[model samples]
Target: MESSFQSENENSFNIYLKDISKFKPLKREEEHDLIIHVKKGDKAAMKKLIEANLRFVVSVASNYRNQGMPLADLVNEGNIGLIRSAKRFDETKNFKFISYAVWWIRQAILQAMSEQSRIMKLPLNRVSTIHNVGKVVSKLEQKLKRFPTCDEIAKHLKIDEGDVREAFAIGSGHSSLDSPFSNEDDGSLLDLIENEQAPSPDDKIDGYFLGNEIEDLLNTLKRREAEVLRLYYGIDCERSHTLEEIAAKYNLTRERIRQIKERAIKRLKHPSRNTSLRKFHQG
Candidate 1:
C-alpha cells in the first residue's frame, strides 16, 4: 500500500519536472561561471542556479515524504530552502552545491512540520495503530535497555514484523486531513467531514445541567465499564485518555480497551439509559 502511494508521488513529480525541463542540469564549469556572476548580485545567475538544482531539491524532499507534509509541499519547502541556499551560498566553499543545500532543505521541512502538522490529521485507524505501536515500543525500550527491532516488537505484539515497521513509518509522518490518499483519488478526507457548529448558549446551559446528571446515568453501567468511559471521555480525569494509557492501567490489550469503551458507548445509546439526557434536547 505504501509502495503504491510512493509510486504515485514519483509519477506526479515526474510530470512536474517535465514542465520545467528547459532548466538543464548545470555542469561543473558552467556552475563556476554562474557562481562568479551570482557573487556580483546577478538575479539571472541566481535564477539559473535555483532552476538548475530543483531536481536535487526534489530528491532531498522525497526523503521527508513520510515526515508529515505532502510530497508536493515538501518539494515546495525544499525549493524555498534551495532559494535561501542560493542567496547565502559562498562561492569559495570548495564543495558541491547540493551537499551544502541539503541541510537547508531538511531544516525547511522540519520547520514546516513544526508550523503546520498540528492542524493536520490522519485516519483514526492509523492513529490508533501508531499509538498502540508506540506504547509497545516504549515498553520494549525499557525492558530491553535499548530500542527494540521490528522483529522484537512483532514478537511482543504477536503481530508481523512488517506491520510493526509500517507502524513506525506511520508514526513518523502526519497526513493532512485534506490531502489525497493517492494521485488518482479524486477527493480528500475532507469530503466526508462537515464543519461542526459550536454549541448555542442555551444548549451550553442545558449541557451544564446534563453534566450534573451524567454521573447518575453512568452509574447504571458496570463499575469498570462506567469508569473506562469516564477516563476515556475525561469526565473527571483532567483530560481524555488514549487507549494505550487506559489499556496499560487496566493491564489489557489496547484492542480490548477499545472494545470495552465501544460497548459502553453503545449501551449509552440505548433509549433506556439516556431518557433523562434526551429531555434536554429540543430537536
Candidate 2:
C-alpha cells in the first residue's frame, strides 16, 4: 500500500511538471489581458495564471528539496505560494510576476521547513540570509558535486565568511542523516546531538518562570527605580513602564511613589547589581 501510494504521488508530480513546462511564456500583451481578467473577477484567468507558474514554483522549490524534505511536499507548499502570488499580484507594482512570486515562494517554503526542521523557528532577518545561503550552497554543490567552502559561499553571497558559516550551520539543521554528509547507520545526526545532553522539561520550565519572576519583581518597584535598573542593563528603554504604572499599583501619586521608592532603594541591598545600603544614604 505504501509503495502504491508513493508511485501515485510520483506520477502525479511528473505529469504536473510536464504540463506546466509546456506553457508558452506570457508576453506583455498577454499578461495585461490576464491582469484585466483577474481584476474583473475572472476565476479562470487566475487559475490559468497559477497553472502557468507551477513550473517556476517547482524550480524554486527544487533548491530547497536538499533540506531533507519530501520533494512532493515542498512542491505542494510552493504551489500554495504560487496561488497566493496570483491573487495578490498588482499590475501597477512595476515588477514582473516572477520576481514578486519568488518572494512568496521562498516564504512558503521557509515556513514549512521551519515547522518541520530540527532548529524550529528562524528570526525574520536570519530566515532571508539563510535562504540566500541555501540557494548559493545548492548551486555550488550542483556545479562541483560537493559542498562549497565557506570562503567561496561568502564571495558568492557578498556576505562575511562568519555569517556564511553561521547561515550554513542553521540551514544544515534541516537535514536528517540520510542527507549528503552522513555515512553512519547507528542513528541520525540529530540523534547523536540529542544523545549528548539536553535540558529536561522541568529545567526548561524552571528557567522560563525564573526569568518571568525576576521581570515581575523588577516591575514591583517605582517607575524610576525600574527604569534606572532596566536601562542600566539595557532592558526597558523603549516605552518602559511609565511612573504611572507603578504609582497606580502603590495607590500614590507618581511623585510620592518616586520619593518613597528612592528612600526604600537607599535602604535596600541588591547584590546582583553591586548596589549596597551603605553607599549613598543613612538609615
Candidate 3:
C-alpha cells in the first residue's frame, strides 16, 4: 500500500507539472482582462489566472528549497499567495501582476517556513523584518566593501539599534546541539547544556497574571487603535499582519496605517497609561 501511494503521488506531481507547463503565461493585456474578471467574481477567470501563474510560483518556491521545507509545500504556500494576489490585484495601478504578486508569494512562503522550520518560532512580522534587514545589509556591504555594524545597519534601515541586534540574533540559523566541540574528540555540545522542559509553577502563574493585565491594558485604547495593535503584535491572533494588509482592511493608505500604528504605540508607551506594564520595558 505504501509503494502504491508513493507511485500515485509521483504520477500526480508529474501531471501537475505537465499542466503548468502547458499554461503559457499571460501577456499584459490578457492579464488585465482576467484581473477584471477576477474582480467581478468570475471563478473561471480566477482559476485561469492561478493556473497561468503556477509555474511562476514554482520558480519562486525553488529559491527557498534549502530552508528545510519540501519544494511541493513551499509551492503550495506560494499558490495561496497567488490566489490572494488575484483577489487583490489592482488593474488601475498599471503595474504588472507578477510584480505585485511576488511580494505576496514570498511573504506566504517565508511565513510557512518560519513556522515549520524552527523549534523556536519567531513572529511573522519579525521574520519579515529580519529578511528586510538582511537585504539592506547585503546592499550596504556591496557599497561599503565590508560588513556593517549594528548601528550603521540600523541607521541605513531607519530602525532602532536594538531592533537590528534582535533581527541578527534571531536570523542566525540554528545549529545541532549534538555537533562535536571543536575538531577534538571531546563530548558533544549537548552534553554540556541542560534541557528544561515546561515553565516553572511560579513562572506559569506570573504569565497568566501578566496576560490578563495586558489584555486589560489593551482595553484602554480606542477600538480601532486596540484592534490595530492586537493585529500588528498578534497579541491574540495566530500571526501579525503587515501594515499594507491592515491598510486594506481599513480602506486606508499604507502611510495612514503606519501613522495609526505609531500613534497607538505612543499611547501604549506613555508612562501614565501603561504604569502597570513597566516590567515589559525592563530588561
- Report the number of the highest-lDDT candidate: 3
Clashing pairs in 2: none
Ranked by TM-score from best down, the candidates are: 3, 2, 1
Better model by lDDT: candidate 1 vs candidate 3: 3
> Which predicted model would earn the best TM-score?
3
Of candidates 3 and 2, the better by TM-score: 3
lDDT per model, in order? 0.62, 0.56, 0.64
RMSD of each: 22.3, 24.9, 22.5
Give per-residue lDDT, candidate 2, residue 227: 48
Tens-digit per-residue lDDT, 1-283, candidate 3: 9999868876887788887899987766687899999989999999989998899899989998877876778889999978967876656642357755765677678667765655257677797778878788768866874446667888987889878766754453211112232233333322221113222232112123233444666777789988876666445443455555678889999899777866765665565665554443231
Could you give candidate 1's per-residue lDDT for residues 1-283 as a string of tens digits? 9999988987987799786676777766677788888878899998899889888777777876876678888889888878866755555533345545665566566556644653246666666666677788768866874446667878887888767755644343222222232334443322222112322223123133323345666787789888887766445432345566678899999899888866765676566765544343332
Global Cα lDDT for candidate 3: 0.64
Q: Candidate 2: how many backbone clashes?
A: 0
What is the Å distance of residue 130 in model 1 from its true position? 30
Q: Which portions of model 1 miss their true places by more than 4 Å?
A: 1-14, 118-283
TM-score of 3: 0.43
lDDT assessment of candidate 2: 0.56
